[model samples]
Target: MLKVAIVGYGGIAKGPHTSAWKKIENAKVVAACDIRPERLDLAKSAFSSNIGLYEDYKEMIDKEKPDIVDICTPNYLHSPIAVYALEKGAHVICEKPDAISVEDALKMQAAKEASGKVLMTIRNNRYSAGSQYLKHLVTSGQAGEIYSGRCGWIRKRGIPGKGGWFTTKAQSGGGPLIDLGVHMIDLAIYLMGNPKAVSVTGNTYSKFADNTEKADSSHATFGQAKEDGIYDVEDLAMGFVKFDNGSCLQIEFSWASNIKRETRFVQLRGTKKGLEFRDGIIDVFDGGRNTKRARIKHNVDARKLDTGIAKVLNGHEANIRHFVDVITKGVEPVFTIEQGVDMIKILSGIYESAQTGKEVLL
Candidate 1:
C-alpha cells in the first residue's frame, strides 16, 4: 500500500480529500499536519484516532516518511511545502493554482524532476464528465481549429473564510481570479488545446469587503478579518490573453459582484463547431449557423452544491482517483508540470497587468 499523509487539515482536506482517500484501495492517509490543534483534532475525529498529527509538516515528513503527500494548504504555502515533500522522496498532490507565482511553480517543477517523483495539481474540473466529454469532442475534431473563447465565474456575495488566507493576497494570491478563475481559465486553455499565452491585459476590483454596505449580506459568508488579517486582494478580476497560436481568450471571475446570483460561463468558437459550458452544462453547436445544438449532462450532485462556490463543481473524488492511477499504474497525469507552470505564468501576467495598467508580455 502507498502510505500517504495530508498537510493542512482545512475544509477541502477534511471534506473532499478524506472522501477521495476512502475510495482508493492502495493509498491510506496515515498522518496529518496542521498548525492549529483544533484542526488536527477535527482531522482525527473524521479519520482514525490512531492517525499521526504534527504541527509542522517538515517534522511530519522527516519522521513518517510517507510515500505521498497531499497538500491542501493556502496558495502561497503550496510550492515550498510541495518542493520539500518531493525532495523528501514523496510524490505530491497539490491543490489548485499550484503556486502563487511562476517562479515558485518553476522551482517546484525542477524539484519534481530532480526527485523523479510525480507532482500533480488538483484541477478537479478536468475529471468532470462535462470536461471529459468536451476534451473527447475537441480532440476528435468535432471542434476544429479554435479562434477565441470567453469564460467567467461571478457571484453576488460569496467571499469564503473572510479574514483568513482566502482574503489575504500574500497567502491566497489575488482573489477570485486565482481561486475560481484558475479553474475556468484552465478549462478554457485545456479545451483550446493548451495554447501558449503571448500577452495578457487585465483589471481587478475590490468592492465588497471594503464596503459591507454594498455587499449583499443575505448571501454573504464574508467573515470578519482577524486583528492580523487582511483584505488586500481583489474581489473581481477580468482579463484577455493572446496565445502564440494567434487565438485569444477572455476570462473573468469575482468572489462578489453585482450580479443577480452565482453565474458561470465558458464558450469556444472553432472552425467546425463551437462548445460551451454554462452553469455546469456542456453544449455543442454547429460553427457556421450556430443553431444545431447538443447538450451533455454531467453526473453532478446539484442538490448538494457548495453555495459558497456555486459556479464550479467539485471533482475532488475523480481527481484523487486519477492520482491513484498515476501512482499504482505509472500512468501520465492529465495535467503536467509545464501546464501548471504555464497557468502560473498567465495568472501572474494578469496580476501584473492589473497593477501596471499595461498589457504584460509573457
Candidate 2:
C-alpha cells in the first residue's frame, strides 16, 4: 500500500480526491494539510483514522514521509509545492495548469529530473473512454493524418467570482484559458502526438468582469470579492496555434460570455476520417467510397465523471498506478515530463500572443 499525503484540503480534496482514494485498493490518504485550520479540520472529520493534519504542508511532509504527494493547490503554487515534494523523495501528482509560466514549468521539470521522481499533472480528460477511443483511432491509422482542429470551452457567465485568487493575475494565472482551456489544449496535443507549436496568435477580454452589479445574477461565488480591488484577468480568450507538422489549432475559452450554448467541444479533421463530439456524443464521419457516420458510445458512470475534480482525480489514480507499476515492474509511463513542458510552452506562447498583439513564434 502506498501512503499518500494530500496538500491543500479545498473543495477538490473533499469532493473527488477523497472519494477516488476510497476506490483505490492499496492506496490510503495518510496525511492532509491546508493553510486554513478549518479545512484541515474538515478533512480530519471526513477521514477519521487519526490521519495527520497540519497547517504547514512541509511539516506534514517531514513528519509523515508519504510515498506520494498530491498537490491540489492554485495554479501559481503548483511548481513550488511540486518541486518541494519531489525533492523530499515523494512522487508528485499536481492538479493541472502545472504552473503559471513556462519558466516555472521548466523548473518543475528540472526538479523532477534531479529527483528521478515521477511527476504527473492531472489532465483526466485523456482518461475518458471517449478520449481513449479517439486516441486509438488516431494512432491505429484509422483517423489517418490529422490536418487541422478546433477545440474550445464555452461557458455562459460562469466566472468564479467567489474566489478572488481566480480573478487575481498572480494566483490563478489567466482565467478560463488556464483554468479550462488547458484541458482542451492537452487533449489536442495528445491527439496530435505532441507536435511542436510553432506560433500563436490570440486575444483576451475582460469587459464583463468590470461590471460587478450583475455578480449575484451570474451565479458566481462572492465570498472572496473585494469591493474596490483589482480584477485583472481575462474573462474570455481565443488563440490560433500553428504546429511544426503544418497542422493548426483554433482554441477558445470563456468564463463569462453572452453566448447561448455552454459546452466543451473538439472537432478534428483528418485525411481519412473526421471526429466531432458535442453534448457528450461522439460522431465519426469517414472519407471513403461510401461515406458513413459512426456513433460511439462510452462506458462510464455519468454521476462520477462530470465534474473537473472527479475527472482530475480519476486521471490522477491512473497516473499514480502507472508510475507505481513502472517503478516496481520496469515499465514506462504513457506520458512524460517532456510532453508536459511542450504543452506549457504552447500555453505561454498563446498568452504572449494576446499580450503583444502579434503572432508569437515558438
lDDT of each candidate versus the true structure: 0.83, 0.78
**lDDT measured at residue 122 in model 2 versus the true structure, 0 to 100:** 78
Per-model TM-score versus the true fold:
0.90, 0.89
Per candidate, the number of residue pairs that clash is 0, 1
lDDT of 2 by residue, 174-196 (tens): 78898888898888878877788
Tens digit per residue, CA lDDT, model 1, 180-291:
8889999899888889999999999888666554445332443234544578889999999999999999998988877777888889998988888887676678844555
Candidate 1, residue 330: how far the Cα is off, in Å:
1.5
Quote the positional error of residue 116 for candidate 2 in Å.
0.5
Question: In model 1, which regions exceed 4 Å deviation?
Answer: 213-228, 287-314
Maximum-TM-score candidate? 1
